[model samples]
Target: MAGQRRILVIGATGTAGRQVVAQSLKAGAEVRAAARDPGTAGLPDGAEVVRVDLADPDGLRAPLDGVEAVFLLWPFATAEGMPAILDAVAARARRVVYLSSAAVRDHERRIERMIERSGLEWTFLRPHAFAANALRWAGRIRAEAVVREPYGAAAMPPLHERDLAAVAVRALTGDGHDGATYELTGPETLTQAEQATVIGEVIGRPVRWEEISPQAARRRMLDRGWPPEAVDGVLRAQAEMVTEPAAATPTVEEVTGAPARTFRAWVTDHADRFRAP
Candidate 1:
């Protein structure tokens, strides 16, 4: 609705970051995609690609120049390097929208504070269980039509990355969202077992969620190359979620002018991933 300005996407190749880039372009913002390796980012044409490794804070300087807004996606597990990184971004960008977790773990909270004090116009998007997270089950389903994990009864409101990106784009381009902290979730709550059923329905098979011990789940995640602490956190969250299901919210529709997508839609969009190779 106003003059377009360059918006920098920090994790341009990621699930949500890719949508941010694409949606920003649709929203009429000039997009600058930043990644550790711009050569392999594979972002759509018309994006001005640049290299900025968050591990090296000073490296962000060049890529962030002339950026009017930033979609801050933290790909790291810790905030040890974020102070310097935020400094580099704040020096150039007038606006920033952070892709934060609803879990609000310690490191993320610390980074949130820094952004609040950074003097840039900011908004925080805290999204719950990502629907695309079911991609983890894609491999297992493709091979055996079964998903083995703890907390099969644990419920989640899995928000689509596209919905998250739509809200982020609105915050980046439009007005009145400044100082807002949006809690985003999908349109409905579905348990882990139900999610498996939905996947099965989408793929024309009987997908089953087999309950396993927490220790076995932890071991499996560790074997999948997940860091130890993050694995523990995932199991811990799922364990806690058994009694308290994740709640859906209307924030996505309020901001994006469209309701948050359901897990069925996400599974439909990514059904090919579950197809046997």
Candidate 2:
């Protein structure tokens, strides 16, 4: 941690990974943005752009060479190829800060076991619903002023991507974060309907929420080219959380020393995406 560290960021073009790259660069870490196609990753200035295909482990070795730390994002649904991937990273990197999900807490020991077996310094960030999830309703809000979805009353404490990235940067470059699992969430819990209403208020529109059946919602997602498995996962997760007590956490503030941005703030930042042409 004393000398200049080289950090590799996988999925560098993604919503969260982009922020990770930006924050890491701002922190003065020598950053490498890794993606399948380096040509279009659009990495921040001063960061080296490299091509690393996750599907082909042989090709990944070169890009990871001499890297001190890695920001691993599991784009695959299941951790099927994780063993080989973690082994590869552990071979070169001293630390790994993984972008994980809150669902991992339900089976905490299993995930921790896997990371521990990797024999590398590790930090797991288990974040709840993302503020960017609201972007899913952008098309509807732009057209009809009504966001239709199932489980309208299901509440989630949505953490902003920037907040998550800030924590990742700290864990990657700082000490005392190894082997830590941080559960990140927004400052407050709001239902899906309430989130839509907040977006409307931020955009200065009268956007309303229309509840639909889970089956219908699944069909709609499928029609829009979402895979069946993903559709099922979304509906099942929403239905299970509908009447359950929402889980809120202060991990963002604890890790970043700043309050997590509200959903309203996220809306204001991305209001242009929902603006009428």
Candidate 3:
């Protein structure tokens, strides 16, 4: 809240984390962007990039030093080492804003509880599916102009990383956001199939969505080195979304004082990722 408050951003190399680092710098906060490899984190010029492994909380002391606030993104699949990490964080930073998933799984809840008990002010951002997740289809779109996945009819309000980051920066620097859980989403809901079509429209191609069996998807994900439990969890969530479509939320606009960006806007912003090389 004062002149150039020091902000440390965990998971700075990730999709939403990258935006948070950039936006926090734009807000004139002195940002220390922490990642596993600070040398190649590629954060903005104003940030001070540092190496930190969340699994090894001892390395967090340097990054947390003189950091008034933190934007945390839990990169692990489990909450095994979170308590120690929070302990390190609480020793230095007064506030922490965690990027949580909208699904709100048990592991995430456990982490939240740990943050709550750490005696630090905190805000949890529970964003719906990220629009950037569609980048997983980039390879297929570039090669075949097709996205092959199950649950083509599963409608989800994909939240833009920028909007999520904007709300995050506010919580990191502003007041009255402590102990808040913001359910952030984009302006509209689109089925997976429709999202594919929108990408095609943005990039001037006919991108198609080919529905595959969930078993096939599960196999493919596991082969790609995803954890078996995470693969199964993703598949189960998608299957549930088919009948129970996710809707858009107004929290993004409420917090940032601007309408949440649309899925089309997100596609347009990152059109080159889907374009043929």
Residue by residue across 150-251, what tens digits does model 2's lDDT show?
899898888889999999999988888998999998889999999998988888888899988888888888899998977887787887778884688988
| Residue-level lDDT tens digits of model 3 in 30-122 | 999998887778889988999888878999998899999999998776889898898899999999999888888988989999988899999
Candidate 1 local lDDT, residue 127: 93
TM-score of each: 0.97, 0.94, 0.97
Ranking by TM-score: 3, 1, 2
lDDT (Cα, tens digit) per residue for candidate 1, span 130-203: 99989989989999999998899999899999999999998888888889999999999999999999999998
**Which clashing pairs does model 1 show?**
none
lDDT of 1: 0.90
Q: Using lDDT, give the best candidate's number.
A: 3
lDDT of 2: 0.85
> Each candidate's lDDT (Cα)?
0.90, 0.85, 0.91
lDDT score of residue 222 within candidate 1: 89
Least well predicted 10-residue stretch by lDDT in candidate 1: 1-10
